[model samples]
Target: MSENITLTVNGEPREVEQGTTGTDLFGGDKAVLVMRIDGELRDLFREIPDGASVEPVTAQDPEGLAVLRHSAAHVLAQAVQQINPSAKLGIGPPVTDGFYYDFDVAEAFTPDDLKKLEKAMQRIVNEGQTFNRRVITDAEGLEELAHEPYKCELIGLKGNAANAAEGAEAEVGGGELTIYDNVRRDGTVAWGDLCRGPHVPSTKVLGNAFKLMRSAAAYWRGSEKNPQLQRIYGTAWPTKDELKAYLERLAEAEKRDHRKLGAELDLFSFPENIGPGLPVFHPKGGIIKREMEDYVRRRHIEEGFSYVGTPHIAKEDLFYTSGHLPYYADGMFPPLDVDGQNYRLKAMNCPMHNEIFRSRGRSYRELPLRFFEFGTVYRDEKSGVLSGLTRVRMITQDDSHSYVTPEQAPGEIKHLLDFILGLLRDFGMNDFYLELSTRDVDGDKKDKFIGTDEQWDIATKVLSDVALESGLELVPDPGGAAFYGPKISVQARDAIGRTWQMSTIQYDFNQPARFGLEYQAADGSRQQPVMVHSAKFGSIERFLGVLVEHYAGAFPAWLAPVQVLAVPVAEEYYDYLQDVAMKLREAGVRVEVDMSDDRFPKKIRNASKSKAPFILIAGEEDRDNGAVSFRFRDGSQKNGVPVADAIAEITRVITERQNTDPTAG
Candidate 1:
């Protein structure tokens, strides 16, 4: 030993022998899954440097969970290759809350195959194989991973990776290329993968807390043009309890899946002829959509927005003037030739709004002009990425644009941010945080962004300051901005704690200039106006989808397609129930009488299934007393309320926008 060296272990100075590994420093704490050496995560078995500040990463911490999941991914790959020797490796990267590995196999994996793989993985975990890191040159890596064409490709991109998608970072990003080998206690190599890793010390750290999820077909690197492969998804946690909890959450999420609930509630449908990503709202769904539109439109009028209408398609030259032609051509539908001119289905409303601003204007008094529209735009979303209404081809944006002088940019951004937050709150999505998405100034993506360097700097800082001043949590999303400008997005958490990007406020200095949008300034000078783009609901279709899941289809009374279901206890009480429903209708409650031949209990069950907020039942006693019984969504009831009083109470709830069953308390 070359003498002892001083190191700071959890803020306490300690002397350890030179070249002592982090595992030795934290030998007493088995729960310390990994160690952070000088603010950088490193393998516990890696040696610590002199004067290095080391901190233990417990199994419950985020970084520790990532390590556990990634190590579990490696074990999964090993199990797959062990079961099928010919299966070539692709990429196995950790994702949000889980990890998945892609493999090129002759046939897709079956459920039985996954079961076998899980058992094999557990065995490997119990064996406690050591994960050994080895630095290798490109030539050496290429030679070692010759069978893995995908890995070889990643090796070629060692320092210059073009992956914007998740999971690709595990292969290439930083300085050097390295391979991690799974070494058995007997000095025999069990398995390995080419990775830039800081994994847990051994397979034993994975424990029995991992379960192999289902497998699916995935393109090699998320590119449609790339080779397709079979991908196995798996989830790992620090303890079996956490794994059980995650599984329970997954079960709940599956039950709340909008597609399933949409069919059950008759809210929406995707017909075979309508094409994928195109959904047709049923009458019930249309009611919800219309209510949303009406509320947003009222808010726009109150907020001083000039409601404008634009055609669905525009001349191709219009997009070119707004910089969408060549840069955004991939995301836009191919142009239609009309009279020797090209016309495109608009992918965004901002370009058209710019055209409206430039149509005819010349006064400083109209400097901060705001335009609003429920503009339906079309986008060529990749087939693989399309899901229900959330990722549809035809999106209806509650889009608005504000054209202001350069000096008023900050104030206008703040105003839009406040409007977006209030709108989300009104829709019952109260839990929110702000995300500032700015240009990727330091990366290869700079060329993809428009506007001068000075303009980008000013726009980013202004948005950031406005976001920070809102007193909400601000998360930075570099490289997530649109090509034209930086943006602030509202991220709202739903009922089950899943975050959704609900609204966005983008600041643009390029498009106005590009479109030659000008307004006279206070000094009597023509100035290129700054543009602020905002979509309170992002898209009506998407927000409806989110709410369907958020509320589990039990919309509040005001938003529910049918607010009240009136049921008669007996045939003789039909007239009484109908009278009560008529009174409710007069009170602006959406009431429907169950005049069907079904029994009273079945009628109640139908109301429950429909998720109507209120159920009014009139029986012989109620008819004699001129009273109605109330049944709420949660199967609770309050009987013997006067019919007039019942109508007043129900209307009051709806008018007050209470997002709960009447008897929820």
Candidate 2:
């Protein structure tokens, strides 16, 4: 029986028969399809359920393909258990690029073993086996899994994984649990796993558009304390072309990796001896950071922020007053004892900035007193999760705080939104989206919050309204708010379609009240002032890291460590090239002359490898002509241009922030 149901297909309304699967909407074309009901992903066979909204998705939408890949993971898990009966099933979940499944096995699964598993998965998908879901009483499940120790452990957890087990952790807490059993056409159950599923209907939905990527050891549940499990990684698509594209994108991203570029370009380093997560900025690295920080400093001053400095190690009382010690102590470096008093490397700038406000008796005129600082902080991160500059222990945050009267808070917030976004754009980043996070009102730790309900309601509204009225698209992130306040976060999308959080403006009431901060009002009443903590470059170190990945280390001439490098054809031309460097320096450009005894071609290659935006080649004839030949990083050259003309063009490009040389060959 067909009933009338309407759906918005790719932004246009279309009528369809009831009970129509998402695959039916695609008309059997086998394109990667993302489907959602009322803006949320629903499996293809998701019931129409009486006029529910549905939207078809394409492989172009990354999430759509992820759902397809996640479904493929279940197929792989079922195939593995089918081939190796003793291989205990674990958890497999979709990740950023694809999915990985963990298993408790007696021996490592080699590359050869992965090929065998891939073949088995292919056979299952080719067979068109259906995935069936079963829900049973918790007690019944305990009996069914009694023989499987790992499943027994999960059953004991009620599925709250405490110890990391195969593919997941085993903890105790939560709701009734369920298992998904993959069944053959004959209704025989071939394999099953404890799971929370929204899987595609059958293995055929995975098609032949998937491949096993790699095999690695994963802690049973991503916890270091848990038993290790062999995890097989894989990617899947609704079509072959999409799968191929995804693999190519993965390769491109790898090639543009910041760690690799940093070493090759001689920009930064993190020596193992210097310690994990503590990055060292080389001379070139220092230049990049200096430019970034100097730019930020100018913006802060222009925005009416008064610069301030604070000691890196502060008395533990500071954090205790800020209420960070007992609750957030885990993420911070351990405290150090100093002069019979305990101290700690600052993990936050709010506490110190609070003391600065208390330095004088503030007045209503100074109600919105803004203090700014570039404070370095430290944290002790878990070793297993550490990665390049992305997840570092030491970072210098470009932080600021504005104390404002309740009535002035809104304007302050609006100014912050515009200013932060503007600064990010100037750094050659244009794509931006915002997320406004607020407190978990229904959480158990609700009492951990400090502000009165009225203050909370006002602050949250001001932030949300500012984000909305600023003409920027913003999404509300429930329960994503800081423990002490609500926040607005701005993220920039990189060239490879990845997003990075670059700026944040959080409205905090907890810190002000915790430190007993207040100002004398117009009526002579000592009233608590609200605090707006914001950072355009969340951390200078982290911002540089994001910019590195954004431009793939090919920074614009304005921000490049060495914007111009001169290659002298002979030692006799060195004096002329050195003069050229001086000219560029006088023109406010970072330039260098290659004076080493290396060959000219070798010097040019070294400059290009360092991502220099322009290369100046000085030869005898060119030097004699009071000119120099120019080569650009983007493969263009200008022959025998006068030194004055070259300087004028290069300086114009640098001043205008033009990434490509227009006058080059």
C-alpha lDDT values of all predictions: 0.88, 0.80
Candidate 1 lDDT by residue in tens digits, 1-665: 38999999899999989999978878778888789989988888899998999999987788888878888999999999999999988878888888999999999999999999999999999998998989989999999889888888888776666653357678665677889999999989998888878888788878888998899998877878988999999999988898999899899888889999999999999998979888999999999999999999999999999999999999998899899878899999999999999999999998888877888966779867999999999999988889998899999999999988888899998999888888888888889999999889888787889878899899999999999999999999999899999999999999898999999999988898888888887798888888999999999999999999999888988899998888888889888888788888888788888889998788888878988888888888899899999887767789999988988888888999876554342
Residue 640 CA error for candidate 1 (Å)?
1.8
Clashes of each: 0, 9
| lDDT score at residue 552, model 2, on the 0-100 scale | 85
Error of model 2, residue 111, in angstroms: 4.0
What TM-score number comes out for model 1?
0.95
Which tens-of-lDDT digit does each residue in 99-215 have in candidate 2? Answer: 888878899988899899989998988877766656667788778877666566667666445343433431122454666677778898767766655466677777778999999
Q: Which residue pairs show collisions in model 1? A: none
Question: Judged by TM-score, which candidate is best?
Answer: 1
